[model samples]
Target chain A: MQLAIVVNEGPYTHQASDTAYHFTKAALEKGHGITRVFFYHDGVNNGTRLTVPPQDDRNLQKLWSELGEKHGLDMVVCIAAAQRRGILDADEARRHGKDASNIAAGFRISGLGQLIEAGIEADRLVVFGD
Target chain B: MAQKKKFLYLNRKAPHGTIYALESLEVVLIGAAFEQDVSLAFLDDGVFQLMAGQDTTAAGMKNFSRTFKALGDYDVRKFYVERESLAERGLTVEDLMPITYEDENEDYAEKPSIHLVGRAELAAIIADQDVVLSF
Candidate 1:
């Protein structure tokens, strides 16, 4: 089945992003197609490349980026939410007159329409959040 | 046009002190453009979202409760408020704002959009949906 995943909380502070990652990995292993992985609310924090966890701890941002790269998944961070939380792509940073962009690889910023489209296109929409 | 999917926006948080309720409403407005069969479910603290006379002046946040009124204009009408959730919060349907929509199929009659339903009934409604987006 084609499934869309929504992660609504940030990493470390919440288990939502971690669980979503494992779920997506398992679903992909089973050969089910991923329609999209939408990050909203604090979940947009997962797309920032600035996070640097201790070498011993698991790096969730890297994990997600790698997963998206391996699966060619449509990983999208909601632009509105991202901007509100200061997670910016290079273009967004330039537009906002910020000095730097922090959006990690394999994740793109987009509108909420992508999420609605995912709901319409995917057979199931799974949400992970508080 | 493709088949219209049933979309449910599930609300489980309070109106203030968090961004979920406001953001969820934003999605509902945006999603309305897709012409899907959309429904909003208010349970737990989410019932506070529809409470009448919400004054955000002291809180200093945007009084977004008024936005719910505009949803009717977007062709997004159904709002399912769980009966048990209200009772637990010591609120009745009368405590909520009077949100209504004009029914084009019925000579443009003004009709209430909120539907007070029991937990079981809400569950059945949820089962009938193609997509359920929770906040």
Candidate 2:
């Protein structure tokens, strides 16, 4: 089954993100196709290029990026949430005269339409949340 | 396309505290991906999901309430705000931003429709939905 996974937690502080990631990986291992991963609320922070973790810690952002690269997956962050939290892409940051954009490769900042489309298109849209 | 199922995501708790807010987002998005019509209502403590001008850095948490504004991207515009919940907590719809706030009433899409009702009424609303997951 094709599944759409929604992630509402960031890598730190909550296990929500970890749980979603593992679920997606396992689904893939089982030969299920994941339509897309929608990140909202603090989950949007996962798209930031500015994230820096300690050497000993796991780099979840890098892992997500790699997942998208190795396979064709769409990682979408809600724009409204990103903007309210002051997260902008390189284009937006440059256009808004900000210093930089954290929404970079492996993830694209989009409206909820992708989510809607995925939900409609995917066979099963299983949610993993708090 | 499948007929859009009405999905109302009720969010409680602030961003980065626990995974409540994040988990809600995921479920809602997944619902939408399934071509279900999804709406989000912030009530009681859930209203905090739309609070603006947060200082999460002090708490070592990245503020994601602004993500509420992004609901438009998900085609999530219907918001059911409880009047009593706002007043009891000293919060007014004006205090929140980027939300199409509504009072609990017959017109309010939430269950019971009253701005505030007893727990029994709330339960009926939950029972009516194809899905009602809490944060």
Candidate 3:
């Protein structure tokens, strides 16, 4: 089955991100094709490369990036939501006149149309949030 | 040969307090372009989204309550409001806005789009869905 995931909360503050990550990993292990992973609302925080957790704690941003890299996953952060929360890619940062970009590796910024498209293409659309 | 997938937008939060309600509506409008078999389920505080005579002027925000009226124009007509959620909140279907759509096949006659259902019925509706987008 082709699966699409939408994560709606940020890291640390909520368990949504962690649960989504584990569910996604399990889905991949089960040989399910991941059509896309869309980050909306506070979930865009998961795509920032600037997060640095303690030596003991897990780093969700890095884990998602690594997972996307390994599986060639289409991880997309909603541009509207990302911009509202200050998560930006190089092009977005340049356009907004910001000094730096913090979009993590393996995640791209796109429109909500990608989400609707995921619903159209994927057999299952799973959501994890508050 | 991709078939028309049964897509259900599960809304469980109130409008204005969170962005979920508004953004979820936006996705529904956009998804209509894909011509999928779409239905919307309003449960929990989500039933407040369809409350009639909502004025956001005092709150200083865009009053998007009117947008619900335009949904039928996009050929997205199914709206299931959970009966228990409304009763729990001391609300009845009469408190909600009258949302209707024109049925062209039936001589373009007007028909109510909102359907009130029990929790079990709503669960059955969810189980029938191929894709459930919760907000």
Candidate 4:
């Protein structure tokens, strides 16, 4: 089955990102095709490369980016939500007159249309949030 | 073309306070353009989203309650408001906004869009969905 994941909360502050990450890994291990992972609301914070966790705690942003790199996943951060939360890509940062981009590797900023498209195309769309 | 999927957007929070309600509405608006079978369920504090006379002026937020009125224009008609949630919160159906849509097939007659249901019925609706999005 083709699965699409939607994360609505940011990392660390909530267990939503961790649950989503584990669910994604489990689904991939079961051989399910993950078509897209959309980051909305505070969930866009998961795409920021500036996060630095303690030596003991896991870095969720890094985990998601690494998962995407390994599985060739489409990690999309909603542009509207990202902008509201200050999560930006290189081009978006440049266009918006920001100093720098913080979008972690393997994540792309796009519109809400991508989320709707994922629901239409993927076999399942699972949302994780508070 | 892909098969039309049954999409159920689950709302379990109130409007304002958090950004979920507004952002979820954004998705619902965009999702309507896909022409898929879509339905919305309001549970827990989610029922507060449908109450009438919502004034965000004091809250200093954009009054997004009006957006629910425009949902009917997008061919998104099914809105399941959980009865238990409302009753628990000491609210009744009359307290909610009178949201309606024109039934194009029935000579464009205006019809009520909100469907008040019990927990069991809402559960069945969720079970029938191909995808369930909660925020």
> How would you encode candidate 2's per-residue C-alpha lDDT over A49-111 as one tens digit per residue?
788999999888888888888778888987866776777998778878998788857998887
- Candidate with maximal TM-score: 1
Report the C-alpha displacement of residue B123, candidate 1, in angstroms: 0.7
Q: Please list the residue runs of candidate 3 whose C-alpha ends up more than 4 Å from where it truly belongs after superposition.
A: none
Q: How much lDDT does each candidate structure score?
A: 0.97, 0.69, 0.93, 0.93
Stretches > 4 Å off in candidate 2: B13-135
DockQ by candidate, in order: 0.90, 0.11, 0.68, 0.86
Q: How does the DockQ of candidate 2 come out? A: 0.11
The value of fnat for model 1 is: 0.86
- Return the TM-score for each candidate structure: 0.99, 0.61, 0.94, 0.97
Query: For residues B46-103, could you state the per-residue lDDT of candidate 3 as single tens digits?
Result: 9999999999898887789898998998888999999999999999999999999999
lDDT of 1 by residue, A4-103 (tens): 9999999999999999999999999999999999999999999999999999999999999999999999999999999999999999999999999999
Task: Supply the global lDDT for candidate 4.
Answer: 0.93
lDDT of 3: 0.93
> What residue pairs are clashing in model 1?
none
**CA shift at A83, candidate 4, in angstroms?**
0.6
Candidate 3, residue B122: how far the Cα is off, in Å: 0.9
> Candidate 4 lDDT, tens digit per residue, A1-130?
9999999899989999999999999999999999899999899999999999998999999999999999999999999999999998889989989999999999999999899888888888888988
Which stretches in model 4 have alpha-carbon errors above 4 Å? Answer: none
TM-score of 2: 0.61
Best by DockQ: 1
Candidate order by decreasing lDDT: 1, 4, 3, 2
